[model samples]
Target: MKHYFIAHKLFLLFLAKFFLTYILLTVVYQLYLGGFQQNQIDGITQLVSQNTQQLMRVLDMDVLVLKDKGASVMVFYKQKYIARIIEGCNAISIIILFVSFIVAFSGKIKPTLLFICMGSLVIYGLNVVRIALLVVLLDAYPEQTAVWHGTIFPLFIYGVVFLLWVLWVTKILDYAKKTV
Candidate 1:
């Protein structure tokens, strides 16, 4: 095992390859999830509907509308977009799945399974941060919310993901020459 970690320099190379693959897979997955994401939206809507008052208490936002926006329920809180919960499966979940899939692909069988489980958890945390930032933007700059949620946040999150992959490949995978 020690020899496998040290002498097998090719393993480091393979790890870098796997890390890059994971990133591409994750981004592709995110793009897919960027689509409607109906089911997740629906589940979240249902939960909110059931605990509407509790949600109001939690967010301190007054709900003014809960009408059918064609296919989805457009819930307006304080004249801002609290949420738009859709009704079926959407592309966003695919992002989570893809990130996990690609990381898993790096190691088949046992290794894949472990990486998928870990990667999923990490991605979920990142997703929550993404949502939180969107919510903040929605509250702070209602007019420019679209710019933040749709563009800025994606770039920031992807940059973070890319940096993470770079760190994993160069530092964790022992591919970089140590300076210190």
Candidate 2:
């Protein structure tokens, strides 16, 4: 047992770091949600909605308007509601997971912090685009909203995160080799 533990020490350490970070972040997030004022929008979801609105406007989809709907945001196109943006659609949890994974395979402190910040921004930006595109797609193809929302968009976001993780691991491995 001791030999096996020694051989897998690094892997065990990574797992411990990942879980601890994930759990801590998740608890903080839950506390944040709990502290929200009644009828107020969560900050992250509001940012996502605003970004999506801006993107739609830039893309010449000015017909759409974003309205705060208590805990969610609603996208209306020419006075007709198109889609509702909920908390789950905001991508905070996904960002948390991404950050946790990167921190687990962390290299130097500065690089790790920078990577987490940049990666989180990238994920947040992608999520805004995803939501905006989803709204447009759903409006155009209402019949396929289920397929698009449930599978395609999720797969795209997760795929990007997976690629980022792969890149982080490659860099960590390279750094380890150099240091050794």
Candidate 3:
């Protein structure tokens, strides 16, 4: 048992750090969300919806995002109701997961923090674009809504995160080799 533990110490450390960071951040996010009334949307989700509206508009799409009486925004394009932007659409949960992985294999404090911030921004921007694209595409192909929303978009977002993780790991590995 001792030999097994010794041989896999780094992997164990990574798992510990990843889980701890993930849990801590998730708890904090839940607490922040808990402060909002059940009928109201949290600030992050609201901002994400608004940003999607703006991006779609910039692309010359006739888009509108209106706050519902409940905890979501109604998205309309071409004057037709297309979708709803909810808390899950905001991508904070995905950002939390991404941050946890980076912190788990963390390098120096400055680079780690910088990478976290940059990676988060990338995730946020991409999420907004994802939402916008989904809205537009769903409006066009209502019959294929399930495929677009359930499979394609989720795969796209997760794929980007996986790519970012690979980049971070490779960069740190190179740094480690140079310092040796």
Please give each candidate's TM-score: 0.48, 0.91, 0.95
Q: Write the per-residue lDDT of candidate 2 for residues 1-180, one digit (tens) a residue.
A: 999999999899989999999999999998998888777778878878888888988887854555565777889865678888877888999999999998888878998898899889999999999988888788789999889999999999999999888878777436556657
lDDT of each: 0.53, 0.85, 0.93
Query: What is the Cα-based lDDT of residue 137 in candidate 3?
Result: 93
Q: Give the per-residue lDDT digits (tens) of candidate 1, residues 29-82.
A: 556546744434444334434344344546765654354645455556567766
* True-structure Cα RMSD, model 1: 8.2
Residue 39 lDDT in candidate 2: 71
**Candidates sorted by lDDT, best first:** 3, 2, 1
lDDT of 3 at 135: 91
lDDT by residue for model 3 (1-180), tens: 999999999899999999999999999999999999998999999999989989998899999999998999999999999999999999999999999999999988998999999999999999999999999899889999999999999999999999999888877435456557
By summed lDDT, the worst window of 10 consecutive residues in model 2 runs over: 170-179
TM-score of model 2 relative to the true fold? Answer: 0.91
Q: Scored by Cα lDDT, where does model 2 land?
A: 0.85
The predicted structure with the larger lDDT, 2 or 3, is 3
